[model samples]
Target: MGLTHEFFLLRSESDDEPVEQVVLSDNLVLYIWDSFRWIPAFNPSTKENHVGLNYHGITLIRHEGANLLKDICLSWSSLFSLAPSTLQLTGDFVMDENGNGRYEKLNFTRDDLTKPLTTLAAIADRAFLENYIIVHHGI
Candidate 1:
């Protein structure tokens, strides 16, 4: 069907703080098919299933107390591009303007996921959490 990935801030394994995880899915085939009324087709020239989509893998940044920040997921096509740095920068701005003056935690919602690329960019831009250890998953 599709791949599902999650990112979250985790406290110590022994700590009691609840992990606030954000989840995203890669369902581009479905999205494009429904949104554009077109289905993916095989490219005889390339000998590949041509959906013309590229997806970002999930990554995590860890901090003291075992806390973590999930990097953003992204996708791109010949006509469109979504970058991790972009999301990271946006997240930094969102935090500066609306976050609680701290980068210790980040939050997002399902509605945010309706636009996964933009949302992940916002999360990655969390500049305050720069010191955390980065963990990559599902590459």
Candidate 2:
């Protein structure tokens, strides 16, 4: 199989609750609760970073109607680093409920500004885990 990328979000069927946008790609899986504005992007080996346009908070909580949302949320964060030209993933994970998450490394390289910035790309198909702890905490 080849490397695949996708964007996702967890939303409530009712309007009384807030929606959660989730992003699971390779060794990184981010959960944004629509409050902190900080979407998490993690790499099992190199580093993990969250992407957002602004810096709100690392977490957010919303209580609307008769429902309460108590889950990991990212808000109020900005993508300070320009989108990396590449990503280097060093692990594998099942980030989705249906067991469709990808695991690998991404190499992010800088571009020469004049070449029409190349679309960011990631490398997949490698497994480099320190142990079960890496999978559990995902730090």
* Candidate number of the best TM-score: 1
Q: RMSD for each model, in Å, please?
A: 17.8, 17.0
User: How far is 108's C-alpha from truth in model 1 (Å)?
Assistant: 20
For model 1, what is the C-alpha lDDT against the true structure?
Answer: 0.33
lDDT of 1 by residue, 51-126 (tens): 3222244333334212211221333231134333222211222245555464332233333334654443344444
What's each prediction's TM-score?
0.29, 0.22
lDDT of each: 0.33, 0.24
What TM-score does candidate 1 get on C-alpha atoms?
A: 0.29
Residue 19, candidate 2: alpha-carbon lDDT: 28
**Candidate 2: residue 126 Cα off by (Å):** 36
Shift in Å, residue 17, candidate 1: 4.8
Per-candidate count of clashing residue pairs (backbone under 3 Å): 5, 25
